[model samples]
Target: YSHHLKQGGAYKCSASNIRWEVTRETHIEYKTTLWEDHLTHQQRNSWIIAGLLWEITANSEDITAIHLPHFIDYQALNDLDPPLIQIANFKDGSVSLEPASKVHPTRVVFENPKFSLLGVIICLLPCIRPIPVKGLVMVYHSQEAADVTLHVYIIPDDPAMQEAIKLKEKGSRHIMKPPVVRSMYFGHDYLLKSPCKQVEIKPKQGVEFCYVRSGQTINFYEVYSKNVNENITLWLHAMNSETCLWEAEVRPGDLSSHGDQTEADSQYDLINREHRRNLIKHINVMQPICSNLLDYNIITDEEKEAILSHPTASEKKR
Candidate 1:
């Protein structure tokens, strides 16, 4: 069976006779591009998938040009050279990155000698665009979660990346948390808090959808409380509008009742978040970000000036 993303345009796997729904367990359950498992020191923090992985089955047609939906935006005809764009050919053992072309702002195209698994990977600055994409809010607490600590992640709704997170969170013992998938905007503030007085969340602050502006980076916000037994309702708050966007309940001894709780919100939360996150850092102009933040009205003037006072663009962005 041919696999497709929600857009139904970025085909995950395309083959002549084979079309199947592959899950995290298919091929490699613990691996999704699984870069970290095979990456070298030099390759570390050097690349991220353009969006999602494309897996092809056998009985496959001969390969030619494959249209991949990239995460980057090129205003001109193209911007090549530095921050190279390449086709990530997933082979039996190693994944190879071969040079490719940016045919459009949203599309990256490449060719393959024979089909295996395919995806787009870009190097260096100006990778992720500011545009919104589908996002998933995943929460978890290990069966033996020490001190009743909770781990919440706001991530893109990409299956591979989600599987990778599942792999990393093996310690959770597969305890299910109702995941909410919806549009999430970068630069906007998202806060997950517990309404119970006994439940205390740290940093006491909200996080930017793309806190680091890198798609490769993952946000794991920790929530904690001492040994208590009441079911705690955790609200995913869109702080800019002071509204509760989504919520889920976590019971101390039981997690089964909420397994069927996944749901989607309406079109707009002022702005929506992306499936993958921001990694684009190349910017000739950085002053507008301050204004952007001010327009959101989320920060105080003091906070704005402090962010602006930083010497470098990167600092200001952080």
Candidate 2:
């Protein structure tokens, strides 16, 4: 089954200046340069304008109710078989997607005025048994601009993800940590919450410690301790009950616990990090390219050198 999935074609992010492709393994691949450059000037303008409008309406907070009746029709522009991304802004400050034929309708309506829909990226891969219709919608509110929103719609990725979305639609609340989260560092502030009333993080080696106080605020009892290690556990002390809250393993430097980096891993991380920066820049500035932006190179000379200089594949695996 894995071998069959490996042969699946790529899922595309066609609207991006850089062509992004996701393999069946979920590894994202990018073309070195803009694929839309080949597009006619008028066509390219449509892409840019659509992306720009998406960046604006999605980020607006406290939107004047008067301006909510507008709907930008992007389907008329790009000639892609399946539209890259399509959005509609309704009078109620709600949004909807005009799906391709036979595809499910996607909507972004906010019940809470504090949240606003930003943008959506839909990923679909053909030939896979359980077709993974997974993508992220950029969401934000006027008050908290820095925090990330996790309202995922995993249509067919995993049964659990699909079930969670179903339960949510029925007015049930479910929360879980993301698969890839930012690493925790000494003295750095983080928003921590415990299912139980109390939660603590003690160092496996040293005297460094942190915990959740009366509120959800995380209190770092010891910062910059030299004894941070590869192994650490979060102890959730129950409050108002006898059962423990939750327990999970965590590492000091690596949030995802990717472990020691190899040459390929380092190179991939560097590129991936820059890709994320590009996405953020696009959202903030609404410019596809600017003088201050990093150069778009699929693989740099320095990176190639590092890959070549690394120990043989066998040794690196050891």
Candidate 3:
């Protein structure tokens, strides 16, 4: 029995026929430029697909729930039961709270706390999905004297809020004290006690004072006696941690011993003597003479003739 011939495209053909068809057919080859364009387009499409997939995956993992804490300003501190110094949103999706009293109990409260929005933004880069913040706390410390006041600032870190605390501790460590001046005067040696603790004496000048210490009379004297007193001024000074009190005493009509004319005259005389000695020494060094020409009596002849008529034959040839 003969099998019915299946007449379709060569699907039922043998492997040889399929191979022959693949080899014989004019295989269309892609040009290099066209192939490059195609590859670029495919790559672009693949990137777009990958980007979409990544976005979808990220959205699935991203945190949609977030609890933002209330931001406190300087004015809010007065009404709040607990003074809030700083508030921070951490990287592990956690929030940290800091109290002003805990940070720096001695620090004065800020009337208007300013937030560093840019600083917060820069510091929160690591925790991008959730908002993270770094906060600053300010406290006020009244100055010992009403004229001066101190403000202490604090920053929150993993380590306890110790910036302001350290500052307060340091401030308390060194108590402010009124300045005391202790000085002695010359000629009459005595300890002079005054609100002014330090005294300045000029050259060729002296001050006298007396003080009683430990049931004994103490005399002090600061005798600034110098022959040349260019800078002489009595300075009443007070010593403090920051600065020392000072004054400049410029006494007019105080002339130096050597006048300008006398100095100029002395300098000129010395210079003239030096110049004269130099001239005499130069003349002495140039004392060597033309002994041969002099022996030939060339010096007696005047001008051109003397040089022309020399003693030696070589001189005559010249």
Off by over 4 Å in 1: 1-50, 53-117, 120-129, 210-217, 253-318
Ranking by lDDT: 1, 2, 3
Q: What is the C-alpha RMSD of each candidate to the true structure, in Å?
A: 20.3, 20.6, 41.0
Which pairs, if any, clash in model 2? none
How many clashes show up per model? 17, 0, 12
Put down candidate 1 lDDT per residue, 2-37, tens digits, no spaces: 222221111223211112222222221111234444
CA lDDT of each prediction against the hidden true structure: 0.54, 0.27, 0.24
Give the TM-scores of the predictions, in the order they appear: 0.46, 0.20, 0.14
> Model 2: how far is 245 from its true place, Å?
6.5
Mind sharing the TM-score for model 1? 0.46
Q: Which ten residues in a row have the lowest lDDT in candidate 3?
A: 48-57
Model 2 over residues 4-96: C-alpha lDDT tens digits? 112223211212321112223322222121223233454333332122122222212322111111112222223323454433222343444
lDDT by residue for model 3 (126-179), tens = 222222122222223232323222222212221122332444444322112221
Superior candidate under lDDT, 2 versus 3? 2
Candidate 2 ranges beyond 4 A from true positions: 1-226, 235-246, 252-266, 269-318
Better of 1 and 2 by lDDT: 1
